[model samples]
Target chain A: MADEHVEADNAEAIIARIEHKSRKIESLLKQYRPVEALKTALEGSPPNTRDERCKSANWIMVHRAIMAIKDVDGMFSSLDPEYYDILMKYLYRGLSTGDRPTCDQCLRIHEKLTERAGLGCILRSLSDTVNTV
Target chain B: MAAVEVHRFAQCITCHAWSPDRSMLAFCPNNNEVHIYTLMQSKWEKLHVLQKHDQIISGIDWSARSNKIVTSSHDRNSYVWNLEGSEWVPTLVILRLNRAALCVQWSPKENKFAVGSGAKTVCICYYEQENNWWVSKLIRKRHDSSVTSVAWHPNNILLATASTDGKCRIFSTYIKVVDAKESKTVSSSDAKFGELILQLDLSSSWAFGVRWSPSGNTLAYVGHNSMIYFVDEVGPSPLAQNVAFRDLPLRDVLFLSERLVVGVGFDCNPMVFAADERGIWSFIRFLGERRITSSGPKYGSQLSGAFRTLYGQPKHGLSNDTNDHSRPQGTVHENCINCIVPLGTSGSSKVMRFSTSGLDGKVVVWDLENQADLSEYF
Candidate 1:
């Protein structure tokens, strides 16, 4: 009963954090600052060992920002290398277990990344993940 | 009776064009390279690979008279290919755009071509004998968004452009040196190069394709709003009609005759639109046996379908193929049909057979003489 209480509190905290970040991302998107919105969505928090928060808020926000952004070429080409690792992590996860919309977004990002930075960027992300583990 | 022969490929064919004799086919596999295939001994064989672009090729146009192919790509570059002996030589046309080039087409005369770009401009390119290279002039100032498709008038001077900005525009691309002023009797005499003739607001939706009829007076275009619109300019006042079909957005439109048009897109079937002499355009019928609307669940059941999808369950067991992505079941094209080109003698308004390539990696030839109802024709 005590462990269950702790788990509920943790879930509440995650939800609260997601709500705050989602508001920031949505406001940025409304202001037509998609690049800034994308940055905030992906880099707002440190790398989470638990991907629940990362996949829930950040992933959806990133997808929304991408759909809103006019300069898809610019966004993909100018992404930080570290962000690709996060993207690939979600991409594989989404492909294997994500919902249809999530999987679609992941595939779209993969295509854009491949188009802008070449297959090397995606391959590099995979290798980085393996080396880190 | 529409005789349809479908050929499947390993990769999605983003665009396709046919050679003059209808003996060879050139198509882009949604990649940087364009492949040329020819049928020999009743089997299609890969003949050549035109590799020049560094990005996805969006458009391909084969000039029947000159036997040349012009291709445009997301790399912001367009190349004109000339067949030399057995190999193809690519001459890059200077489009001078920073964004992706979306569509390319050869004019009726084959002396020049046009390239539409996401940079909000269409470039009219012609060969310069002095420099021995192709050069382009910009038609900037009209389009506010990416140009999706372009069609040249049979007269070879008037060019029609469709854009994602919800507008279909006509421009006078009459180059004095290359094109003779034969069309001046029919078109406006005072029209100069880069002059906007007509700018019609199609819809709030992005316009996908445009085509000029053989007579050069009628224009047909499709939009993302699932609408097929036609503008008939033969009368004193131009008449525009919009037919909103209850289906997904159409991607391409081709004029089969003066009064008939075929549009294909996300529905994965070719649908016919016809116009009477009064210029009243209407949706006639679909050309294929695949009835997407009848088989697919109605919008009333869409909420339940969404709920089922949320649980990762297939709605009604029929929508299982939706997750398959490329291979859509029970259709001539497994995905959206992207390009359609007529196959017959040039300048003939009545084409018996036409070819279509789609995102499903299938190239199909639909014979109208066999498939279309002949009661009306007879």
Candidate 2:
């Protein structure tokens, strides 16, 4: 019985560690700067080559970070208000500039931000657009 | 090539092909009763309805792979009936619905199914090992208002949905796997689909049904303008093509083949408008069936051709007739062409036509071969 409890505790510890790491990765991705992380995914990680695999592992680390946000963030609201501030900033940037990037590019930035900033009010606003709320 | 004029025949107000291999036809004369006729032992045999639905059966789908027929009602539940022990048994009842159901369809492979109601969600039911269907995944809060119809992609990996809110959504079934994991915490299942995917704006016009082609290359939708729109993945985005009836409007549209499309509307004078050499929608005058769709009234070519000659109306009725013979040439029954199916390859083979119901609420089978009456039901 004690051993089983210990096993459960270890599992909890692993999950907590993953969550902590996810937080760090979420903060980095929220920057959505596309400088360090995306570069690592494209260049650092070549799944085929040994050298590439090491780099690719780094890229996967970032993906794991993003995928982790997907798992833990579901407990509360899908939209995090803290994330909304970042989204609005991006939306504001796009509207202000005639030079707009592709929506797909915008989506990556938005998703990363959504992961970092869980904004309740802004999520509600966005959700209301489709009468889905 | 072979044309038969329909004479006295029972026009099916509604019909469902029970099994795909040997499709059985069922028609509802009233709200609760179903008249069944099957082709068994190489002959047509009318089967007695073993059961009854207390309310109106708005939509019916027969599993083409199995002897199962699914029927939906306004009472907010869908019943799956299976042929067992020489009798139909209620195998499954999906009662999770809190609203009225509009349509039900079985997946092409027969393993999964979709149900849509006035509710904002659509439940994709997967048959479990216990022989019961479970709400495996829910595409929750899908519509602004109500979802009228849902269709599974032929591959079953994608879902196409239409709603009364005038928006159609295409969702990847992959997201359900994501949401299913979250369902462990029921209180927090805001649903990954809660996020916007692809949204089609139909203005205030309600989108009633959506279907993807068997090849998954094209999508066709039926909307309020009595309209049909086709979209294919090309160029940078999907291009919408307007096919069939520029003005007359349509009740529904079905894709039977790549080039052949079928459409029917609330208008009584049911017309099949096949595209001409230029692929422009052209109305068929029902100058008699080129063949028979089933066994039905033979609307003889003599009357139709005579009617055409006496009126000297154009075969392709495209515009208003200021000519003297153009006056009503005569009014055909508006409700008679309730449901139509093209018999041959393109689904527009013009060989024989099958109809559901309109006037008498009977399953009328037409034999377009002899241009004479074939069979009728009370």
How far residue B288's Cα lies from its native spot in candidate 1, in Å, is 1.4
What are the per-model DockQ values?
Answer: 0.01, 0.01
Question: Where is model 2 more than 4 Å wrong at Cα?
Answer: A1-133, B1-15, B39-45, B50-52, B131-136, B174-197, B234-236, B243-248, B269-333, B336-355, B359-378
Candidate 1 has a DockQ of 0.01
Q: What tens digits encode model 1's per-residue C-alpha lDDT throughout A19-101?
A: 78779988998898887887776664433334455346655665676556566557765677556545555566556656786
| Residue B207 lDDT in candidate 1 | 86
lDDT, model 1, position B201 = 75
Docking class of 2: incorrect
Question: Candidate 1 — which residues are off by over 4 angstroms?
Answer: A1-133, B1-3, B180-186, B234-236, B292-330, B372-378
Give TM-scores of the second chain, every candidate. Answer: 0.89, 0.67
lDDT of 1 by residue, B135-244 (tens): 89999978999999999988788889999887899888977777653645455545799998888875756888899887877899987766788998733467888876
